[model samples]
Target chain A: DAMVIQNPRYQVTQFGKPVTLSCSQTLNHNVMYWYQQKSSQAPKLLFHYYDKDFNNEADTPDNFQSRRPNTSFCFLDIRSPGLGDAAMYLCATSRDLGLETQYFGPGTRLLVL
Target chain B: GESVGLHLPTLSVQEGDNSIINCAYSNSASDYFIWYKQESGKGPQFIIDIRSNMDKRQGQRVTVLLNKTVKHLSLQIAATQPGDSAVYFCAENEDTGFQKLVFGTGTRLLVSP
Candidate 1:
């Protein structure tokens, strides 16, 4: 099935350490997104890429960064992991920017100690 | 864009019963609506969608209803089964130059057999 794929379903990182989460898609969608979701909360958009054009949410902290190295692959990088940053990181993709449904991957759960 | 309810509300039903999940969206200008199902520790799966122009849309076993007047969206599942148990979310497709899915506070559905 053509779907979004995330790696390392669970991740453990030390405080102040850097960690990266990866997402790849077989759907070949033009837009990729990164979101942070804590327990019982909605997924919050951190940033997204539109065919290489990176758009970060205004309130997204500078510690969070994303990179789409190619059409099928995107990565979310946390420069300094903190206890508050521990959550499920989700990656999603859509065919285009407008009114299209986004397909999400099984998120990567990050735990910071 | 407030935090989708910090506390998840749950609906419990017997297997084979019909299930209805409701959501109140924030933006009146949202042109499209979608419903997603997220299992434990997994990503959101697309269920059904309804456009602002249409009042209802149906999938295999699920239906989505959109009320632009009240900014409400709902998902109805027939013959709800135990497998249907999950956190259901409603998202509005909003465009502000950039496009994104604004998710409503999700509801957890529990189906007992």
Candidate 2:
């Protein structure tokens, strides 16, 4: 099954430490996205890569950064982890930038201590 | 700033009953809309989508209705089951250069046996 995959379903990091979350896809899609979802809230878009062109949300904090080295892999790096930043990180992929459907991974749950 | 929101924060329905979740968007320029279902501890799964040109779209057991006049979107699920219990969100895609989505607060659907 061609799907999105995320590493370390659960992550624990100390406050102020840096943490990296990874996402890879076998769907061979052209667009990849990263979203932060807190409890009982909607998934908020942090950044996305449309064929390696990074597009960050205007309100996204500078501590959150994303890199897509290639079509199949994308990483989310948090420069300084905070307790409030602990949430589920989701990775999604879509064929193009239009109204196409997006497929999402299981998500990486981050816990900041 | 424009936003998307849901009228109800939570709803409970009995098994085999039909469920309807409503959402309202402030962005009149949003051309695309989608409904997503997020299970506990997992990423959101795409349910259905409706475009501004169309008034409604249907999937296997789900249907999406779009009312451009009022900028309201709705998801109707037939034969609600326990498996359908989850958080449902409505997202609108802004008609910008990029495919950015603004999601609603979300409505929790609880299907009771």
Candidate 3:
């Protein structure tokens, strides 16, 4: 029943260390998304990948990068973690795009020390 | 810049009563509006959605109402139960080919028994 899965429910990293979060989907979705959500705030889109094409948000920092190795696997890499990067990292997937309902994973809580 | 926001940050309702969460959006060109329920320590789950051409849509015990004239959206939960307590968010699909989702500030729903 677990369609979308994110490994390491909680992750801890040093301020300047690089960290990567992994996501996998059993739904065979073509589009995957990454979002960062701080306490009591809205989830902001960091970037998304449609197949092999990656799309980054205008406000997304260069420190954040994403990779989709295949159809079911995607990774979010924070090159240099900062205090402000401590938040929930959510991974979502959609069948195609447009009006499709996006399925979300349980999320990974990242803590930057 | 398009933004989505909630009218209230928190809402408390009796278990047997109905709960209504409101959201406002600045983008009128959004193709689809979706409602998501997110519990603590979990990612968002899709509840219901309404397209720009539709005014209302229903799913199980949840109903999504979209008022394009006012650029407003609302989610109504019938016969609220304690399990329904969570944060509800309204997201607008920007339809920018990537189908970017602009999420609203979440409204915390507390169903008290």
Candidate 4:
């Protein structure tokens, strides 16, 4: 079954330490997205890649960054982890940049200690 | 700023009963809407979707209804079961230059057997 996959379901990082979360897809979709979701809140879009072209949300913090090395893999890097940054990080993919259905991977829960 | 929201934060229902989850959107330009089910410690799974041109669309045991005039959306589950307990979210897609989705603060559906 073609699906999105995220590595390290739970991660623990110290304050000011850098951490990276990975996402890979067997769907071979053209678009990949990163979203941050706090407890009991909606998933907030941080950024997304449409075939290597990065699009960042206006309110996304500068500490967050993403890289898509190939079609199937994308990585999210947090330069400095803060206590407030501890949340679930979700990765999703879609066939294109249209109104297509986006498939999501099991999210990575980040715990900033 | 435009956003999506849900009326109820949580709802409890019997296993054999039906469930209804409602959402409202302030974005008038949103033409696509989707319903997602997210279990604890997992990413959201797509349930159903409806376009602005249509008022309703049905899936295996789920149905999505869109009211463009009121900018409201709803998801109905028939014969709810314990396995249907999860956080339900509604998302709207904005076609502005970049295709992105705005998610609502989800509603927790607790199906009790």
What would the per-residue lDDT of candidate 2 be over residues A33-89, giving only the tens digit for each residue? 999987777888888899979998888999999989999999999999999999999
TM-score of 2: 0.94
Candidate 1: tens digits of C-alpha lDDT, residues A1-113: 99899999999999999999999999999999999999998899999999999998999999999989899999999999889999999999999999899999999999999
TM-score of 1: 0.98
Model 3 residue runs over 4 Å out of place are B1-8
Q: What tens-digit string does per-residue lDDT give for candidate 2 at B11-108?
A: 99999999999998868999889899988998989898888899989999999999999989999999999999999988998766785788888889
What's the true lDDT of residue B55 in model 3? Answer: 93
Report the alpha-carbon TM-score of model 4 versus the true structure: 0.96
Best by DockQ: 1
- Residue range B27-78, candidate 3, lDDT tens digits: 8899898999999999999898889998999989989999999999999999
TM-score of each: 0.98, 0.94, 0.95, 0.96
Name the weakest run of 10 consecutive residues (lDDT summed) in model 4 chain A. A36-45
- Which ranges of candidate 1 are over 4 A from the true structure? none
Clashing pairs in 2: none
Ranking by TM-score: 1, 4, 3, 2
TM (B chain), model 1? 0.94
If ranked by DockQ, best first, what sequence of candidates would result? 1, 4, 3, 2
- Writing each residue's lDDT as its tens digit, candidate 1 over B1-113 gives 74645679999999999999999998888888888899999999988888888998888988888887888888999999999999998888888777678888899999999
**lDDT value, residue B1 of candidate 2:** 30
